[model samples]
Target: MSFINFEILATSIVILCRVVIISLERLFPYNAHQSLLRKGFWNDLGMYTLVQSFVLSQIIFGFAYWLDGITELSSYGLLSSWPIWGQVLLSLVVHDFYIYWFHRWQHHNRYLWRTHEAHHSTEDVDWLSGPRSHSLEILINQTVEFAPLILLGCAPETIAIKGMLDAVWGMYIHSNINIRSGVLQYVINGPEMHRWHHAIDHEAHNMNFGTKFAIWDWIFGTAFFPSGRKPVGYGLGDENFPENYFKQHAWAFRRFRKK
Candidate 1:
């Protein structure tokens, strides 16, 4: 399929995934009391998810193209010889691995945490919560994400397919739907583990950092899956976190408190 056609298909899939996830959340919610119009919902949906994503996609793709121009890497078509499915699968595993480590680092490194805290500021951890990432964080991660595909000459449609997977998995892991993956949770990540990543609980702090796969956490001894209990709360412990979109972005730049 052409890139445009693939983009159309990806868009449809994303919309379908959002609808299905939202419906499931209503039917079997983990946090049954959390409302659809939770606090900061408009800001997250209107500004971060829609506006920031579109604007940054242009900038990230432009940067990747500039880098490719200087290196002329796409001309070699390094990954083009591989089947499209192979390229997509390879990109997913490689980038998922990269994000798993980077995500863990974000929770530990105070400096990087500045670009990451906004993602954890939401008191209500739902499907929309996943996209509430800081612009700098998204810029860095996505540049790392798509740049590889361009540099290695993966099929152009692979980027769209991968992006669809990212959006769907992101929403799935953050959705409020109660998921009992049991053994599957050992391999694939879902709300069961990821919601704890946003939890304010002491035990869950800095644990379950995998994005698409749970094997990283299990392998690295950071997996915190306590059965028969739920997180006491969500979000950063700070009650003073900003609510506006622009203020939230600027909040990441504020001077850190000294010890």
Candidate 2:
């Protein structure tokens, strides 16, 4: 019951933050070249609303708790003794490490890439782009990410904090707002680096797999940042990628169709 409350409170904060950022972007966009509804807004919005709502998250969190039950885990020993803030920070680090590699795998493995390609199908990447994902992708991510949080014995409050931060930061990194973080971009993941992740060009597309921090990319040598320019745009170069949420969810399987 408490967990449900945390989910609601934390997510409400994320949505409020999203409204603020979108408002800022409208007033001061990074690129006048992009439109407010930059292609595929409805598709992304559909997924975003679905995931942000209680119904989908309740299912995902309920599943995560079930997985935790299977393992029979809880905050224990050293991790339990740590302050709540420490626990949350460590949880973020561990979770992001898994996410970085998992995200990279999705790009390299053809089968996984099929599940992720819908996210890349959007030509206009921005705040709402983070939630524009396939159902499989969301399920896999929640499970993978949830497993570590449980194994590490993080508190529910800590998980909520990380979840809120992840949601808000996820939107921030994918945003189109004119933010030039300069050296800070090296320390934390920012729109500048993330936009490169969405680049249609192969060279840029393969880089910057980090979710919250750039340290993983810096260590893995996958970070790419060009001086004085943004990505030409975003997408897989497939005109048939589909603009509808339902179709985009299944867009990956089309490759297996027998002619």
Best by TM-score: 1
lDDT of 2 by residue, 1-259 (tens): 5778877999799889999989978887866677877777765675555643345567777877787678666635336677879988777787789889999999999899987887777788788888877778877887676656666676778778877897799889888888888888888998888888988876797899998999899899999988887677687898877887767766767758656
Question: Whole-model lDDT, candidate 2?
Answer: 0.79
Per-prediction TM-score to the true structure, in the order listed: 0.98, 0.88
Per-residue C-alpha lDDT of model 1 across residues 1-259, encoded as one tens digit per residue: 6678889999999999999999999999999999999999999999999999999999999999999999999999999899989999998888889999999889899989999999999999999998999999999999999999999999888888899998999999999999998899999999999999999999899999999999999999999999999999999989788999999999988988889
Residue 162, model 2: lDDT of: 75
- Cα distance off (Å), candidate 1, residue 125: 0.6
- Error (Å) of candidate 2 at residue 78 is 6.9
Determine which window of 10 residues in candidate 1 has minimal summed lDDT. 1-10
Q: Which residue pairs of candidate 2 clash?
A: none
Lowest-lDDT window of 10 residues in candidate 2?
47-56
Candidates' RMSD to native: 0.8, 2.7
